[model samples]
Target: MELRTLGYFVAVADAGSVSAAAAVVHVTQPAISRQLRQLETELGLELFTRGPGRLSLTAAGQQFLPHARDVLHRADEARAAARTYAAGRLERLTIAAPTTTLTDVIAPFLATLTDDDPMPTVFESDPREAYPALRHGADLAIVTEAPRSTLAARALASLPVWAYVRDDHPWHGRDAVALHELVDETVLALTPSFRPRQILDTALARLGVPLDRVVDCSNPQVAQALAAAGRGVAVVTDDARFGLWPVQIVGRDGPLRIDLFAAWEPEHHAAETLAALAARLGEFCVERYGPDVAPAGHVGQMGREY
Candidate 1:
């Protein structure tokens, strides 16, 4: 019935295996199992069903998971608040940013933080995971699409997608290309789980264009590098390009537009502060990729190569 037991139970449930949970929680499998069993015994209910190689939650466990998580979260919050009050410094703000958009998109607003406030600690995690963490405790989370769960704070901004190509690519010099024309060209895409991939697939479907899929990369950075190498073309935000990855904007597509936003708990110390932060992030993006900037000439000027 200890809090640590509930923590272990939640971890095991999430990992779907005692061994995996132990690895993540930094304990042995048997230890985690023992603690969970003890908690189950104290509660007079079967929390988990243990098989030869399977670990699954029982009905009671399924029903109790959310409550256990809330208890743990509230406990952590109380601890953090007490520490913050004593230390006279808001404990470090932990923010999650989409790996694809964090640096150039979200970092500038963070730069505005005064020396008195501790710099935010940034985490790059799956959007699915990041949203829940923000609702539970993370100070902020940046996402490409609005998450559906009511537990989350809310969407801060909606950003659109832009066409990105290699500097040396044939289309680099072009101001824009017909959306349907891109289907004939080699396309580098993110894994299907990524929002960009879903949007691209849907847009191509609507345009009645069959895409020539060439490279499939999970990491946006790798995809950007592939685009830079003239391997294929990808659509991404200017924030994703940053300074490290070189790219050229061939043009924009209406269907390719994406919104990038921040989500945070309203009950937190500075909910309004997060909104202001979101605005600054949006401004930074507009400054770099807004309508006024023409495509760089060093990039190719030719039309479609194919």
Candidate 2:
């Protein structure tokens, strides 16, 4: 029931063993084991499976893990808030972004911060989790799609999605490839949860193109690597450093593209700071992608046409 016990439980769950959890928490094995037993007794649910040399979560433990993590995260946020208030400085911004955006957008945006400004805390999170993290405590969230909430948001960048191929592949030297042209070829795509993947799927579905033999990758780097190995054509955002031939996806109208947004609550105490950071991020995207990608407007307003 205690916060300390929850922390101990999370450590045990993460480490997968009592002794390992004790090592991480700097507690003796017996103490950790006793605390875990007490926690299970209070909850009236078995959290872990016991074996001679193995420890694993039971169904109940697996179900409880996320809740425990949320509690710990909120506790940490409370402590941070108190400390920042005591120090009489603005609360340090915490920005959460998906892995791809963390590399392409957030990192570059952060490089512009000065010493007088509180250095923002950056964390890599799944795009689906970004908005929720913001609602919970994060100051800023970088997401691919517009958040479902009414949070204030703005388009940060729009990157053209490219089909990458091995140097010797037939499509390597092409300027563009139609979506249907890829229908007959094996495609390496980002995972379903990714915005690019959602866009690609929708486009293909609308065109009645069957995506029967696609390889799903969790990250762009993996997809690019598989394409380099000639496993298939990798679909990703155009990053010249990837060292692959970038072929545009030509639709009937034009090329396919994906937009990234920075979302934040307007009522948050850090609203002004968040807006400033968002503007800087927009500028960073414009510098990298070109002036055409300027932040259009606020999310529900007259901003980016897409």
Candidate 3:
């Protein structure tokens, strides 16, 4: 079966119709329809059931869908491997991470690199999407959530989530604040997609701390600015800004923090090199963040989103 044919099949499955898949794949509807029929002929099973405008996957199709996706993912990894070796060793490095982690953690680590090291191309993704970015094209992915089982992954570090306030604010000199204390004050939080917000939300719910004066911002910098303006206490994993100081958020268990993880496909052509690079990254995170930032031991497991 053609890889293109498989791609079209997956597209059709996602789009719900051959015509709709054609639009996304940028091919004519008749060509897609013909290919789908040929695919069915080769497999000796009907993959879809015809309907008025939409198509539903057949029982066989439903079973085949996951295998098809796996095949496509493997094919993509193969191409990525070929491209990396064909281009030259360490020449095809691309890292994907959440915007805040990309800026705060990865960027700082990259700055410490010498000219001998491979300079990676970086892409900003949501905390959840960071791992999936590897399946798309990224050579390495940094995420707060656990990596998929198929990918080789390692825990980088545990970075503390912070509550930020102006230098003159009453809590600025404090080392840490209780999670329940947030309920009494206006809190500036990032959207749920960010690791800090996820950590905050989970902790608050567990402690039964219902915060009513929470202001949501899409950007951590904005959250810091709002806090500096005395709007609310900024809860984020970002570095302190706007002349603010970071106070560790104390949860019921311990200091509220997010675990950092680096993930990549172990079957990639430069798998060894990628693994080495991820190790170097983990090392740098430890060195830069200081000894207080503990190294995490979780690797290759179905762990929590935080």
Candidate 4:
């Protein structure tokens, strides 16, 4: 069967209807239906059940779905690899990390790749978007939390957390403040789509701090700027705080800490390069931020509620 046929089938399975799949694939419903029919015919199995309403995958389709997804994913990866190779780009390293981590951890580690021959083009993405890329074929990902039952990654390191503000902020002048006091302070926070928000929520629940005045923002640079302008305290990694602002750590307990990890597809072909990057990244972390630093912060398991 054609790779495109596999892709079409996977799209239909995910969307649960030809029209929906058509919309996703930017093709007409009949075209999608025809492709699915062709794929089923070639495979000698009924992949779906036709009904008055939306489509449902048959038992055969259910069995075929993962395999089809794997094939389609590999095909897409091959296309990306070929294009990159043709353009003299041997590797495409996609890092899914918190903005702070990108600045503090991976970005510094990337100095090695930059100085090397045929340097890889590094793509930065938020942790939330990173997992799907890994499933679809990202070279490597750094995340605060891994998905449940995901056996594709290795736990790397855990890093300390810090509450930072603009250098001119009141909190910055103070050497430290009670953790409870942060609840009353105006804070800059990342969007909920990002992992930091989940981490913040989890921490607040554990410490029972009321986060009432959050200024919602998307990027860490923006958040740090807001905090730098003396808006409020911004929570970030210790390394991230030092990298972003000239702010001092002002929490009485010092700062909250979290675990970070590196994950990749176990069956990926570029495992050697990916592993090399991971090792170099870890060594860079130790040199710059200390060996105790996590590649990303862990936040979910502090309390029973999380």
Candidate No. with top TM-score: 3
Candidate 3 has which clashing residue pairs, if any?
A: none
lDDT of 1 by residue, 1-306 (tens): 677888998999999999999999999988988898789889898988988776898998999999999999999999988887565445477888777666666666677767766568887867788767776668877776654444234333444445567665667666556677676667667887887777777776776777665577877777677676767776655444532232332223453555665566645666555555555555566566674322122211111000
Instruction: Output the TM-score of candidate 1.
Output: 0.58
Q: So what's the TM-score on candidate 4?
A: 0.57
Q: Give the TM-score comparing model 2 with the true structure, all chains together.
A: 0.66
Global lDDT of each model? 0.66, 0.81, 0.84, 0.66
Candidate 2 residue spans exceeding 4 A from truth: 1-91, 295-306
lDDT of 4 by residue, 191-214 (tens): 777665666666677676677798
TM-score of each: 0.58, 0.66, 0.68, 0.57
Error of 1 at 17 (Å): 58
Per-residue lDDT tens digits of candidate 2, residues 191-216? 88888888888888878888888999
* Total clashes for model 3: 0
Residue 279, candidate 3: C-alpha displacement in angstroms = 1.2
- The C-alpha RMSD in Å for every predicted model, in order, reads 16.7, 14.2, 14.6, 15.5
Worst 10 residues of 4 by lDDT: 297-306
For model 1, give the 10-residue run with minimal summed lDDT.
297-306
> Residue-wise lDDT of candidate 3 within 95-152, one digit each (tens)?
9888888888888888877777777788888766766677788988887876767777
Position 147, candidate 3: lDDT: 73
Better of 3 and 4 by lDDT: 3
The runs of at least 3 residues in candidate 4 whose Cα sits more than 4 Å from the true structure, single-residue gaps closed, are: 1-98, 114-118, 147-150, 167-170, 173-176, 238-254, 294-306
User: Which one wins by TM-score: 3 or 4?
Assistant: 3
